[model samples]
Target: MVYYVAHRLFSAHDRALGARVAEHLAAEAGADAVFLPFCDTDEEDLVADVKGLRLYQLDTRRLGGLTGMIALLHGPSLDDGVCMEVGYAAALGVPVTILTTDFQTYDRAGRVPAWQFPDPLIEAVAHTVVRGSTLGPRTAAANRFAAFADRNESQIDAAVCHGVDALLHAPAPVRPAPKEQRGVYIEASPYTPDSGLLAAARSSGRPAHVSRRFTAGDPLGAAVEDWNLAAASCALVADVSGPETPPGAAILIGAAAARRQRVIAYQPRPAYTHAPGREPNWRNLMIQYASDLHATTLSDVTAGLES
Candidate 1:
């Protein structure tokens, strides 16, 4: 089974260790895994690494990947991207196992709904349910084990074990699409310095239809960009949290809505602010795409859409 590990990429601390944790789990399970941060998908100007069956197929042999997913819920408020990924994975019928940090309290009110997806909804979709980060280290009692490493290693290792276990145990998903068919389309803005928005979109666990994946520069001419946005299932227009919207982003949103594709707009938290007397124009057209006009979080927009 192939394993996809999804988590927030914006870290104020070390990420290598967490990545290693995911790698270790994949190793222990003897499974193939890909961490989004590590993949370089800009080959051939097509961004073809992730092949979807009309945009929702999470795994396909053509892409040489697995259909099973393991999502890491690091905190009480699930990362908007992570939440989207989990929902996307589930939407496509891929078996998902949630490995969360907040599982200990078993506080459904605090941890699960933070997903903004109704209770028993996320739970019903997951194959393996685990709370802790580590199941325990892949070590022997006779071997030397450091206390510090053990604490961390166990959490990550457990996550993998549970994920693999869940995947192996769940019913297999269907793969009837013809070779090279695509599903679940999206267009991402040119990446900016702050990862908060891009990370949220890419890690939403679904593949994007349009990509600026390899570089910050524009990958296509206006005609091609206009066509891609027109063809996409949805356009995820993300940008830095500010009053002024970027031109490229505005174009995607406008074109996407014009095409009647679902558009999910995310301006990072401090979602939007305007002069006291001024109307928040940021919400003007974007709100038309949102379920709740006043909603500020990414999870709100993606919650029911995926599940």
Candidate 2:
């Protein structure tokens, strides 16, 4: 009955307006909903908000600090907090309706490069693209998100358990150990320092090759294509240590793996690097993931493949 409105993190004025828009739309569609703006204020506020409705807050702005480096090493981005909120909502199957007319698309045409302007942010919204005249469909989609959320509480909790199990017993899957392929194409972010991981993977016997030298740039499109190539040829590895690897890549790989495909995760650490600083409040997501999957870290993955 209640829907969570996941809006872009912003100032009070904009957040209030976005809340009003979501409330209006949800009410018009006969669904009760509320907006939980992201903040770094205190745990009391977060605890209170999460208790009332779904929590729609960002994770961490910590990038290169200890925890941030850990996150990056594990596979998170600077914008991962927002992505985490969205992912958590989606995982809970929460009906997350994004209202964007509340803001305008700035033309940073000259100030910033054309490629950066409307791609990432625009694409995130595009996944749930709302048409101006299609309020009815948008409402329906919101309701669907709500229905998904209804089932999410239990499912998400169970997924946590699964991740933990995966990490503790990663080698239990019993799938035949993949042969040590000659050349494994690795697609990572331009800004990510994955040479260490690449070297680690190779040292373990999997020959790795990256698409480019490296720098921080968008690799969503490239990752998607590369994922498909890897899925088909069994010659690609989703080396997710790149800043450019879109959060959606995780979802895609999960989908592929669900279909009995062999998607290998070359995860090297326990944190998300893309996040900015070291915040104690930064959740230990990778550990939670390991717990949920019933396996230990991918450090066990190499042994599993060899076994």
Candidate 3:
């Protein structure tokens, strides 16, 4: 009966087309489709609007240009606040719709646009959404509302089975807590930005440390340090989606796999890539990747924890 919409924001500078689309969607759904307010907005003004619907604010200003590189070299993490809202959505089991067609395009590695999270913390916890632009153009405003209602009803049913309440919803993992030990290793690669995955390993109750600092010039050196850290670790969490294709955050999953350590490789969808000759048909590829990853639904990460 209730629906939430998450998006970039409403801005005075934005063209009328975007506003028309938002109005159309809000009217179509009948359910309050709240626009995620931008971080630049005054919180006092936002207090009333933020109440009924979930509110999200991301400081994309930091990502204005080449700052990710500079942050990689200097800051503890390049994407510190970037994942905040998504992480919260995952935790609360809310569905998120990314409202942009520009984001749906695949990158060089055959992966969906890098900006969209294929999979992340609280895996099946949020509904990653992408609205169809066609729906708003010709249909009666009322027909659009009916369509929104239909689409959302289907999404909620799927959320029930996902790890929406895993911490409290599911039984605990079978592994014993790690002993308080020295020399912990962390995989802090700029390519794999979902550090929340590290929390799963840390939950084993050991003193684990991840390398939050990274630099491009010393990628090999950084990998070596991670390997050493894994060597010292009782188990290494890695992703095995391969390079060249560079499976975004999944690359860390692959690196951990290469280390021959305990790893829970998060494969968003068998691996979609944009290599020269190996590329799949665009529309078909997008459909497959989204379907396979259950991109619109949240699943439980705790279910994969070793027993």
What do the candidate models score in CA lDDT, each in turn?
A: 0.44, 0.33, 0.31
Minimum summed lDDT over a 10-residue window in model 2 is located at: 64-73
lDDT per residue (tens digit) for residues 99-189 in model 3: 3322132223554443233322212222333333222223333687787765544443233222122212233222223343243344433
Which order, best to worst by TM-score? 1, 2, 3
| Candidate 2 C-alpha lDDT tens digits along 36-82 | 34432232354442331222123211110110000000112323333
Better of 1 and 3 by TM-score: 1
Which model scores highest in lDDT? 1
What stretches of model 3 exceed 4 Å from their correct place?
9-22, 31-83, 103-128, 131-205, 209-307
| RMSD for each of the candidates | 15.7, 15.2, 18.2
Stretches > 4 Å off in candidate 1: 12-14, 25-37, 40-66, 106-120, 133-149, 175-261, 264-307
The positional error of residue 34 in candidate 2, measured at the CA in angstroms, is 6.0
lDDT of 3 at 81: 19
lDDT of 2 at 3: 31
Q: Give candidate 2 misplaced runs (Cα > 4 Å).
A: 1-4, 8-18, 33-78, 85-125, 128-187, 202-223, 226-279, 282-307
What is the alpha-carbon lDDT of model 3 when measured against the actual structure? 0.31
